[model samples]
Target: MVVNVSNLSPRLRQLGLVAVLFGAIPAGLALMGGGYPFQVGITALIFVTLAVSLNLVTGTAGLLSLGHAGFFGVGAYAAALAATKLHWPFLLTLPLAGIVAAALGVIVALPTMRLISIYFAVATLGVGEMIHVSLLNWVSFTRGPMGIRSIPPIEILGLDLSGVIGGYYVAATVAALAIFAVHRLTHSYYGNALRSLREDDQCSAAMGLNPVRLKIEAFAVSCAIAGMAGAVYAHTASFISPDSFRFEESILILAMIVVGGLGSLPGAVIGAVLLIVLPEVLRGIGDFRMIAVGVFMFLSILFLPKGLLGEASAIGLARRQLGAAWRGDIGAGWK
Candidate 1:
């Protein structure tokens, strides 16, 4: 009972922190009472997935994507269609949705890879609008604004996990996986290549980094992850429409990364959780809740330009963790 937590190895400390955070979710929800609080927790976790995925492209790779929500919608629709029309299981639909969204991302990246700066951003906006409009007007396929209803809940190995607590666990698991994957990717040499592109694509290309190919790969991966998040959203929400993935949604995702710290993974997670939970916490403010949220964001930007957990600090923390592992101080965990 008198153990010194600070003296624990980095790897063990990391694992303990993760376990505590994951365990705390249900406990916190229980204390607050399930119902709406559980819903908020589920939504927060889903956005955590989205925020991490978006960070791969916008934060690490230095691509300003304004149409990320379109890919998210694509995944949601893909999962919805497969579940409803083809009677696919949750297991099947999840990966299928990611694959579908990745394919679309690759298609978009192929033509738009040559563009840079605001041009690329504008192109993505157009792509997002196109996806939204198609979903809205395609009537026959997307149900034309009526939206898809009665989608199956999450089930795996014949076990239904659609209820509130089960749903929260599922979402938390996905969010945790996303964070782990992105954390590994960002703290490695591959992630360094992505950062190079972000800092100076032309310089990176001159150094034989193949900037175009890297950009496409990053975009595709990011899209795939976003799609997976969408799949979870569709299954858990049990309904979805084009309205769920609009340009406004893209802005929110972007804002998460920005407010969290453009190049920081921890920042992305913190920002997502903050943005999602802050609004709910302010609900007691009634009419001015949104204004209060806006004010908080403004104050954060004004005071913390680099974010609450900026990229530099995150990278340092990661390096220390990796160093501890590599030195055999942590017994080879998280290397």
Candidate 2:
């Protein structure tokens, strides 16, 4: 039976539509003779989590952070420390990583919350660099540039994930949870406060909203989600280090949110997948791969404007457009 879409609330419609399509992709891929297709699909989930988390600041709070990689690193390292050294359960370590990142976020936000726009981005850049340098110099914590390898895989009820397929499920579940949480938050009164602040801080404050608390809360929550994604990544890659969560990583997440139509969750996912996995699709181009990516990204920013999905949505308005055309439709478009 065809699932009903096109009339639900924006968030509900988006989430349900995604759920329906996601369940079918694996079976279709299998029917088409693809192996372990869910693995790539799962990676998209993890990346989406990172992007949406970044969306909180860039989208809702109107704060541009150039150093989100710092929080992502914090989460991965925390998970590494807990699972490998402390011998904690994988389940136990997952939330702990988020907590660690949240704590760090609070500390960083307290100092930088007063800044905005370019100054805010610059301040976060410094904070991110400090995190990266700390990971390198504080060998005892991060194990230095060598990074923490041999990360333990997730074990659910004592069943260890033996392949990428299982990883897809785990990543998808985490990503779904993050999506729901973000959706709930965005619809809440606090989310309204954030949007108000994003539009105009002085007006938001004049109405008696505490920009500092709201900004700090948004930063803290965003960092926590980044940390959660990082922890998931550590397990998926079975490794960790300062190098993996560098400035580029932060920029990639920022691009995901920015290009995906800013404050939209579905936009975040679409942007992440295009930026993260599409690179693999271009890898066969050899030396031109990076160049193609640059060009594609440039074109996406120029032509797509909001993002690939955003552009696709604009093209999807015609009743004659179905299937292939729909695939080209970027529903992530807003405004």
Q: How high is the lDDT of residue 70 in model 1? A: 97
- Full-model lDDT, candidate 2: 0.79
Q: Where does candidate 2 clash, by residue pair?
A: 309-330, 312-329, 312-330, 313-329, 313-330
Predicted candidate 1 versus true structure: per-residue lDDT over 133-160, tens digit per residue? 9999999999979999999998889988
Candidate 1: where is the Cα deviation over 4 Å? Answer: 1-6, 325-335
- Report the error of model 1 at residue 16, Å: 1.6
Best by TM-score: 1
lDDT of each: 0.90, 0.79
Query: In candidate 2, what are the lDDT values of residues 15-125, reduced to their tens digit?
Result: 665676456655665675554456667667788899989887888788999999899999989998898888787688889999999999999999888887999899999
Root-mean-square deviation of Cα positions for candidate 2 versus the true structure, in angstroms = 6.3
CA RMSD, predictions in order: 2.6, 6.3
